[model samples]
Target: MLTGLKTVSKKQKDQFEKEGYLIIKGLFSKQEIAEIDQTFMEMSKKTIKGCFEPIMDQSSEVEDPLKRYPRMMHPHRVNDVAMKYMLHPKVMLILSDLFNENALAAQSMFYFKPPLARGQALHQDNFYLKVEPGTCIAAWTAVDKADLENGTLLVVPKTNNDEIYCPELADSKESFTNQYVKVPKGLKAVPAIMNQGDVLFFNGNLIHGSYRNKTKDRFRKAFICHYAGESTTKISGFYSPLFREDGSKVEPELNPDSGPCGNEFDTVYPH
Candidate 1:
């Protein structure tokens, strides 16, 4: 167990428990965010197979900027910096406090919400991760200032413990991803405005997503990761070989349940 880690306080833990999400201001330093920016900026110029496949040619037939700079999936498996943040001790410590047990690093993603990029639809993380016994927790680090204009994340408070609802087809005009989860009655989705270096941690079942980048120049870039507790016995095969805080691999049993829609949209979509 990690000792003497002062990242998460008792009040913060209680807030997360009560609201289903918590935002830690400046959880990552400005220097750290700059490093991430430089790394991904360099990466955007080339293709890394299944990780990142940005199109360098702007004159190509693909018009969408996201097609040119798609969200990088499982980036930690390829980039040293991404892996460093995925298992960053401070994040691991806070996750331990939230789970009340050791945490396992399961997945990492970097979103380059460039100008004119479409936002992801509201959906649950476990709907895709399929962590059994408990749900995954997402640590979303905003690399740039996030607001409604630049497509900041949105969440429905107190929806953490709700059962996974089958998703409906999303409006392609607004969302890049096809899956969309409807907010339950009496619940409303609210924007999570954050500054650079801030990290938002939310439950796996939280109904959350963002709107299209309504601004002309700003890009709402973010570094996001998902984790499961040490006791997790199964997880989706896509995120297999979960890692420990020490960087050791642990292969949990594969979870085959793909929610109500089967695996039609299983291919990596914006998240």
Candidate 2:
């Protein structure tokens, strides 16, 4: 085990149990944040022309004249520094607890929220992940300061265990469809504001999304990691590239040699 792993105290764990999410402040150092930001900016500048226009039209309703220029999906494998942060020890500790053992990285994404960008539709991670309930998590780390002005994430309290609900899709050309988790009647959701280097860990079933960035110049950059427990199984119609411990792709099928899945790790977590 890595020394000085950021363990979640009882209070923090309780908060997560109640709200379906928790924020760890300053999980990354300022120097680390700066390096990631620099890497992102450089990559953004290089890929900007080829990416921006198409993604904007697909993911948001912002018109060309009103949209803020933003970048999406920087490949992490291309950057060693990014890959290090993705597998950081502190992160792995929390994930191990959630998954009740060693976990595998299911997906990684880099989201850059520039000024005037529209908020993402409120939805759960499992909507796209298609994994068993409570078997996955999303670790969202801020490379730059995130707040209301810069499109910080907003989440409904205590809504994780509920069955998923379909959200009203805003008129957009986005490729992925969004379905929000149902919120209880008369309850208001809260916005989660995070400073640079902070990481927000939430259940894959949590209902969350961000508000549009209304700030003039600030940019909110977040690196997100999605991980699944050893017992996690694939849902039909949703696909993820499964990998073994050595990172080689596993063949599609369930068998003794196919690795663990379908409640195999139910007792792995120590109560």
Candidate 3:
């Protein structure tokens, strides 16, 4: 017996339904963003066995910045701050509104897309997570200002309702991820220009990705989390041991097979 969360308005839900995504300003505070900035900055210096392992040696010869600084996968497993934010009340509220059911936290990632780093190519989350019956949703929060020149996120509108598409090979020079979802003929790739603390929530099937961090000085840092609706019965093991807002875990059934994207090659996390 849960009433819909009032934190999210119907108008906002309508926008998400129409666009497959919506950007909420100041969903996190300046102080919160700053703390996250500090935490990840410190984490970048050291290597965590399985969570975060960034190369500290400043080697200019490294053509791909990601080789030197890789993204943090599931820091919430070891960091309290990240865990708190992943199950933040506001985020869960917005997600509940979007899913029309309770929201279950699935996966979390932190991207430190440094200058000249390769960006992830366009792809659908369902192609990976394989959430059954319904799809996953992503809540992406910018830790720094994100814009076109600094590898801001790019998304195609109205693709939320589309089926998972098998991705094509992407240009290695521009994209770090191997798979790229082709945008439908009529849709256009739009930029998500966001200030620090802005959260962009989108559907699992929304065609979205980031571009190369072209700037020499800026790092497009972001915290991205994925969630499954209460109705979901199965998902890829890559996102198992989901969590509830109260800091408890919920393990869903495994999806067992590779999604439409196939298992021809190894796949990394896509934010």
Candidate 4:
């Protein structure tokens, strides 16, 4: 517990318990945000060319250039400044409280929304994470101001407790159905408007995704840190590309039936 530091109040905790997510305003300082952004910009300039290099390349068949770069993983090895941000005190405190134990880093991603970017499909983080329900949380910190104009995050309230619905592929265009935990009938989707230094702590089970960035000049960048409880287990069949001390890849046993039906189980960590 950080003494004298403003923490998530009990009332806020109640809101998170009821809504499945909480947005903490101004958790990082401008200096910290700048440092993290600088690191991302530098890493983005590097040309990756190996079994794991594609993790940073965004060039995609999609028209949107933002979608060109896939999520970047295992950045701690590439950027020390980003590693500092990943283990920030404020972020760790909140994770400790929510998980009721010391949390360990499971993954990190840099979602760069260049102009005219296509938004990600709405889905539960666990759909990709493959962790046990309620045992993981994603801490998303914005390196730039996130708002509706630039395609900020939109989340469905109170959906974390619902049964882990079968995840649809990113290409599915259907609206919410029985198989999907649709946004509440009457409540409108809320865009999380955050400053550069703000952080949104969301349950892995929460139904959320971002909109496409429509602005031609402004870019939306977010650094997400995924943390899990100490006892968390890796899903079988999914092999995380994270490198070990000897630079060898560790392939976890995968569940024969895991993954999106016939799609391959793509690991998002250790990139």
- lDDT sort, best first: 1, 3, 4, 2
Provide the global lDDT of candidate 4 against the true structure. 0.64
Number of backbone collisions per candidate: 0, 1, 0, 9
For model 3, the superposed segments whose C-alpha errors exceed 4 Å read 1-6, 257-271
Query: Cα RMSDs of all predictions?
Result: 3.0, 8.5, 3.4, 5.6
Q: For model 4, give the 10-residue run with minimal summed lDDT.
A: 172-181
Alpha-carbon lDDT, every model: 0.86, 0.63, 0.85, 0.64
Candidate 2: residue 76 lDDT (0-100): 42
Candidate number of the best TM-score = 1
Q: Whose TM-score is higher: candidate 1's or candidate 4's?
A: 1
Deviation (Å) of 201 in candidate 3: 0.3
**Considering TM-score, which of the candidate structures 1 and 3 is the better prediction for this target?**
1
Query: What TM-score goes with each of the models?
Result: 0.93, 0.77, 0.92, 0.77
Candidate that scores best on lDDT: 1
User: Which digits, one per residue and each the tens of the lDDT, describe model 4 over residues 145-206?
Assistant: 99998889888888767555675445422211112334646655678889998899988888
Query: What's the alpha carbon RMSD for model 4?
Result: 5.6
- For candidate 2, lDDT tens digit of each residue in 55-77? 33434534531233443432444
- Tens digits of per-residue lDDT, candidate 1, 1-271, equal 4465457788998889887999999877899899999998887778998789776788641467777877888889999988989998878988988999999999998899988788888888889899988899999999999999999999999899899999999877778788899999999999999999999999998899999998878889999999999999998888888999889999989887433112223354322
